[model samples]
Target: MEIFFTILILTLMVSLSGVAARIIPFQIPLPLVQIAMGALLAWPTFGLHVDFDPELFLVLFIPPLLFADGWKTPTSEFLNHGREIIGLALVLVLITVVGIGYLIYWLVPGIPLLAAFALAAVLSPTDAVALSGIVGEGRIPKKIMAILQGEALMNDASGLVSLKFAVAVAMGTMVFTVSGATIEFLKVAIGGLLAGIAICWIYGKSLRLLSRWSGDDPATQTVLLLLLPFASYLIAEHLGVSGILAAVAAGMTITRSGIIRQAPLAMRLRANSVWQMLEFVFNGMVFLLLGLQLPAILETSVTQVEVDPNVDLWMLFVSVVLIYAALMIVRFGWLWTMQLISRRLLTKRPMEFSAYTLRDLLIASFAGVRGAITLAGVLSIPLYLTNGDAFPARYELVFLATGVILFSLLVGVIVLPVLLRGMPRMDKTAQRHELQMARAVMAGSAIESLYKMEERLTADVEENIDADLLKEISSRVIGNLRRRVDGKEDLDRSLLAESLERRFRVTALRAERAEVYHLRATQKISNETMQKLLHDLDLLESLLVEKEE
Candidate 1:
């Protein structure tokens, strides 16, 4: 009951913060506000304390977040930036782990080299949730956004895999050898990829069968989509592989494997809504929980330092600052190098190589704001080794991890907006024009198909169908196509007619819905009857207004 109440209050806090962000006029990021609220509530005066269970956190949060990112990512864009994404996600992660690991060991005394690497691994992945707010709001180039997103998705798997090896070495579960560890990493990564593909294939096939068998039940379809990430994660973890990667792979598979294409429109709509809500709630809770844990983390660090003089809290803080600086420096340098190399090697695609500029490099560097994943990794570190001794500098590790996250968030909040202010805004007019062109092409194809089917339709359904209504609808569609393809004068004339017809139909449907609601409100109609009428109105309105290209 206490736990339930805590969650309820936290959720309320998340909601309040979102509203405050919108209403306050000041451009404070929502997560930053939520984190502050959590910290204040967690103060001693409020007596609020939330202990994070690392394993539970990972299982509950990581899979769905990764899966949603994968599912929503533009596959073509991701592939176009594949080389850069790989460099950032895989190569950059490796560099950070090894480079920062050594730096931490040298700067912070009494921490094992491998344990330091573990800490580095925890801090490595740029959090997608944290980046999305800034990236979405900023006029960052589409290509850069794609690379950042793709890197965020893939790096989580790589970072976690690195953490796994580091922890094993730290816990004495496995002896670290460069060659052996590399082989093991490949095995785990490859195995997880294969497992994810197989799982998604089975899931996709089952989803298609269910859709066919049940005739597109949105509720069932939504539930199945909800379950997929968890199932994929669990299956991969059980196979001793990267569950994060598996979840990612499963999401990508579903998106690309015709599963979503085959689902009913209503089911897709419901599923998207469900996933969006889940992501919002989950991301909010994670950041808030990080804030809630701040007090306890600080206290643990202080106590540990007092008891053992070797555990220097100040040194850990300094190490965090240095490490964060190193992260930015390394990221900027690596990205510049990759761009330079791509320019000379790929003369055919000079535009792709030149797309990244100094400004972009700066934005991308600061965009490496660590969030939930780092928190999860640090918290999940085992308290004791196999010999039952406490993990070395555990509190320090947590403190450093938390410090990096907070610092990174601060950097992102302050720097991103300033950098983005000077960047060019996306051309809304141009985009609308392009969309119009595509819609015109689609309408042309649709008209061709309609003509092809006219004979069969007339022969089979002429008696049942309303031929006049069909002709009017077809005429309006043709007018819409003309409005896009024709001159401004012709467009205005045809558009006015089509617009008036659509307005009349939509207004009638809305009136019907209002009448149904009024009947229900006045207790003149049964709830079931009101619902049925409202549903019909909704379907009618959708048909009248909904446009897809």
Candidate 2:
């Protein structure tokens, strides 16, 4: 009962924080605000302490978040930026581990090299949630967004694998050998990848079977979709592979297979709403949990410092600052070096080379804000090694990890906006123009198909089909396409008129949707009937909006 109330209170807090973020006049990021709330709640005076179970956190939160991100990511864009993403996700992660590992080892006395590397691995991956919060519908280039997202998705596997190796060495489970560790890492990573692909394939086939059996039942479909990420994670982990990567692969498979496109409209709509809510709640809870764990982290750090004469708290603080600085410096340096090399080698690929710029490099550097993954990795560290002795520098590493996360959040909130200030917003006009042109081409193709259908029809069937209605529909479509394509004064006027009509229709549909909700609230309509009507209105509104755009 106590745990149930605590959870309810936390959920209320999350909801209020979300509301406050929207209504508050300040420009502070929502995650930062939520973290502050969490800190306050966890303060000794409040007596609302919450212990973070790292395993539970990872199993419950990470897979769904990663899966959602992967599902939403544009497959074509992901492929286009594949090389750059690999460099950032895999190569950059390894470099951060090696470069910062040695630096931390040198700076902090009594911390083993493997432990230092473990800390580095924990901080290497950029988090999608943090990135989304910082970027928040801002005008950052699409390419930059794609790269950031892709890096965040893929780096989890690399970073976690490195952490696994480092932990083995730290715990005396395995001796560190460069060649041996490299081989193990490859085996683990490749195995995880293959496992994820196989699992996704099986899941996809199962979904198809379920769809056939269930016959477009949105509730059944949505429930099955919800189970997918967890299933993938659990299956991969059981196979001793990267569950994070498995979740990601499962999501990408769903996207690639066009399952989302094939799903019934109601199922897609309901699933989207459910996923969005889940993302909001899970991400909110993560930061709040971070806050709740702060007191414990600080107490541990203090206890460790008191017990060890050589452990200077002030020096540890300095090391934290230095570690953060090294992260930024190394990230920036690598990005610049990669761009330089790519420009030279990919001379013929002007499209690829031309996208790299100083502004983008800076955005990418600052965008490396660590979040849930770092928290999960650091907190998951066992207190005792295999030999039953306390794990060396565990408290110090957790404290440092927390410090890095806070610093990154502060920088993201304060620095990122300033960097993005002068950048041009995405060109809606150009995008709409391209969409219109594509529609015209598609309409032209449709007309050809209609003519073929007419040729196939018997005379009696053709008579019953209403030739005048068909002719009118085709003529109207052709006229609209010509007006859009020609872009002359009269045609432009016609296009504008059509757009205005669509805008008016969309507005009316929105009003109707509101009225339907009001009826439901007033109990004038049954819930089922209201939902069915609302769904229809939503579909109509969406179609109108798309056409207008």
Candidate 3:
């Protein structure tokens, strides 16, 4: 019962955070609001605490979230910006691990090199999810946003893998070598990618067989779809590969597999609705969890600093600020270099780094917000070594990580809007043109298909169907299809007529549903019958309302 109550409270808070974001007079991002609410819950008076188990958290939260991002990612754009993304996700992460690792060791007193690298490894990855939540959608230039998102997707794997090696070396479980690390990285990364693709292939086949056996059971299909990411992660982990990358690969592969498109409309609708709800809940839980940990994390760090004679709280804070600044500087420098290299390579002409606007460079630099993956990765560092000694400077590592994450988020909330404003937005005219073309093609194909369907229906005349009634319905459906492209006055009139018909249909559905309910109330119809009727009405009404919008 206590467990049930805790779940309910967390879910309620997640739901309310959405409402509170809109209700508040000032604009605060949803992630921040949820974090604030969490801190409030953790107040001394409330005394709410949830134990943080790093391993459990990773298995439970990371896979699904990464998978969802991979699923939603536009494959075309991801591929198009492939070079830039690889630079940031793979190369830049390596650079940060080395660069920031040394800086921390040099600047901080008595922190181990291995531990510093682990901290750097975790912080190297940025959170595009938090960025979108902070900046709001459609605000960032589309090109920049695409690259940033791609970076976020790929870097999580690289950063976590690097941390694994660093920790292993620190614990004397594995000896580190340059060549060995490279070979292992390639093996794990490639194996994980293959694992994800293989799993998704199996998923597609399973979906097909399930449909054949059960005949379009939407609930069963959705349940299977929900399991894909976790299956990919666990299987890859068992194989001693990068489970993070596996989850991502599964998501990306499943999207391209086209299984969802082949599924029944009801299944697709239900699956989309369910996934959206789960994504929101999971994301809220992450930020809220971060907030809940804030007070305790701070208290622990303060105590450690107090006991340790080497460092003071103020100096520790200085270290966080310096490290964060170094990250931004390194990030901006790399992005600048990448721009120059890309232009020189693509244009085949010598161009300066200043070819692009400083606004883009600055925006890209500040946009690297350390978020969920960072929190999870840093916390996942083993608390004790093989010899049972506490992991060196564990509290300090956590403190620095949390500090940097918050600093990045706070800086982004303040600075990003200032950089984005007055900058010309990315042109989406090509996208609009493509959408228009797609609609035209769809209308033509639909009309042609309808004609063939009509012929087939008429040819089967053994039953002596009503020919005129069929023709009237076919013409009306064809007229609706023709309104797909926004063009002439006739098209506009057809759309207006369709809109009016949709309203009438909706009204009729509501009336029918009310009648079904009344019959059930009066005992004129069985409860099951009333439910079936209402469900049918709701589905039809859903279509009508969708079209009206």
Candidate 4:
């Protein structure tokens, strides 16, 4: 009962966050609002103190979110910016781990380098989800956003892997060596990617069999689709590899899968709706949970500071500021170096992705905002050493990491808007043109298909059927397609007419949906009938919305 109640409460909070975000007078990111709401719930009067199980949190939340990101990312863009992504996700993570790791050790008197490296590792992976939430969609240039998203996806694995090595060394379980770490990293990374790809491949085959056996069952397929990330993560972990990368790989792989391309329209619609809801809830829950933990984390840190005369709370905060500054500096410097290198060494002409203006560099630097993954990784640090003693500077590490995450978010919220202020909203003119061209082509082909169907039906149906009626219906359908292909002075008017027609149909469909719901409420219609009607309405609405976008 408690578990169910908790779930309902969190879901309510998630919904309210959305409403509240829109209701407020000024603009604020949805994640921040959700986090604030969570903090409110943790007030002393309410006294919500949910246990934070790091392992469970990672397993329950991380995979699906990462998978969704991978699935949404453009495969072609990802490939094109592969070099930039590697520089950020791979090489930069190593740099942060070593440089910031040492900085943490030097700045904080008691913490060891290994423990510091662990903190650095967790901090290295930026949260692209949080970035998008903070910096509104279409606010950043397409190319930049693509690289950032790809970097975020790949860095989760790299950062976490680096943390694993740091932890192992800190715990005295393994001796760290360059050659050994390199070999191990490759094996784990490559194996995890392969694991995810292999799992998804098998899933595609299984889904095909299911389709053959029982026909298109969207519910079953959607449920299976939902399980893909978890399956990839668990299986990869069991095989001794990076589960994070495995989940990401599975998402990316599934996007390129043939099954989805040939999937039934109903299945695609249902799956899209399900994934959208899950992404919203999962993302809200992550930030909300972090907010919930904020009070406790602060209280505990204060207590720890009081307990140890050597540990000053003020200095701890200062350490957080310093560390975050170092991160920005490192990010900016690295990005600038890339730009310089690309200009001087790579080519006389600036590389499209590698070259950047000062403003662009700042945007990229700040956009490297940290969120859920850092929270998960930092929290996942083992509480005790092998000999049962407490892990050194665990409390300090947590405090600093949490502080950095918050600081980074706040800074991003402040700086990103200003950086992006004057930048024109990404021009979608070319995209609109392409979409129009594709629609014209599809409509032409559809007309041909319709004519073929008409011919086949002429012989198959009763010969006594009204020939003029058939002709009129076929003519009406073809007329719509004909408008798509017609190129003349009237093209603009034709588009306007189509747009207006779409709007009218959408409005009517919505009215019908309301009526159906009203009927269901009045017991004039069965719930099943209402649901079917609603589904049809929703499908039509989705099409209209897609066309408008």
Q: For candidate 3, lDDT tens digit of each residue in 387-441?
A: 9999999898999999998899899999999999887665555454454467667
Please list the residue runs of candidate 1 whose C-alpha ends up more than 4 Å from where it truly belongs after superposition. 349-353, 458-510, 521-524, 536-549
- TM-scores of the models, in the order given: 0.91, 0.90, 0.92, 0.94
Q: What's model 4's overall lDDT?
A: 0.89
Task: Give the alpha carbon lDDT tens digit for every residue of 1-549 in model 1.
Answer: 999999899888887878877887777777787788888889999878887898899889889988998898877778877788888998999999999899888888788898899999998999868876645643676767778888898898888889999999888788989899889888878787778778889988898899888888999988988998999999999989889888888877787888888889889878877898898998888888988988888888888889887766677788889988988998888888888887887778753546677888888889889999999998989999989999987888899999999999888988887888867888765564555556556767776777666545666764666778667776786665656555333444544555677888887888878888888999999999987887778777776666321
**Top lDDT model:** 4
Instruction: Show pairs that collide, candidate 1.
Output: none
Please identify model 3 stretches exceeding 4 Å from their true place. Answer: 348-356, 423-437, 459-463, 485-526, 540-549
lDDT of each: 0.83, 0.84, 0.88, 0.89
Native-to-model Cα distance after best TM-score fit, residue 481 in candidate 2, in Å: 7.5
In candidate 3 the C-alpha lDDT for residue 336 amounts to 87
* 1 versus 4: better lDDT goes to: 4
1 against 2, candidate with superior lDDT: 2
Which 10 residues in a row give candidate 3 its minimum summed lDDT?
A: 485-494
For residue 93, what is the lDDT in candidate 3? Answer: 97
Error of 1 at 150 (Å): 0.4
Using TM-score as the yardstick, the better of models 1 and 3 is 3
Please give, for residues 1-549, the per-residue lDDT of candidate 2 as tens digits: 988988987898889987878788877778888888898898889889776889999999999999998888887888888888888998999999999999999998888888999999999989868877766864677878878899999999899889999998888788989899788877777777677678777876776788789887889888988988998899889988889988888888888887788778778888988998988898898888988898888888998899888788898888878898899999999888788877777777633424667888888899899999999999988999987999888888999999999999898888888889978888876666666667656766766776676555535563676677767776776666665545433444545766887888988998998999899999999999998998788788877876764
Q: Which residue pairs show backbone clashes in model 3?
A: none
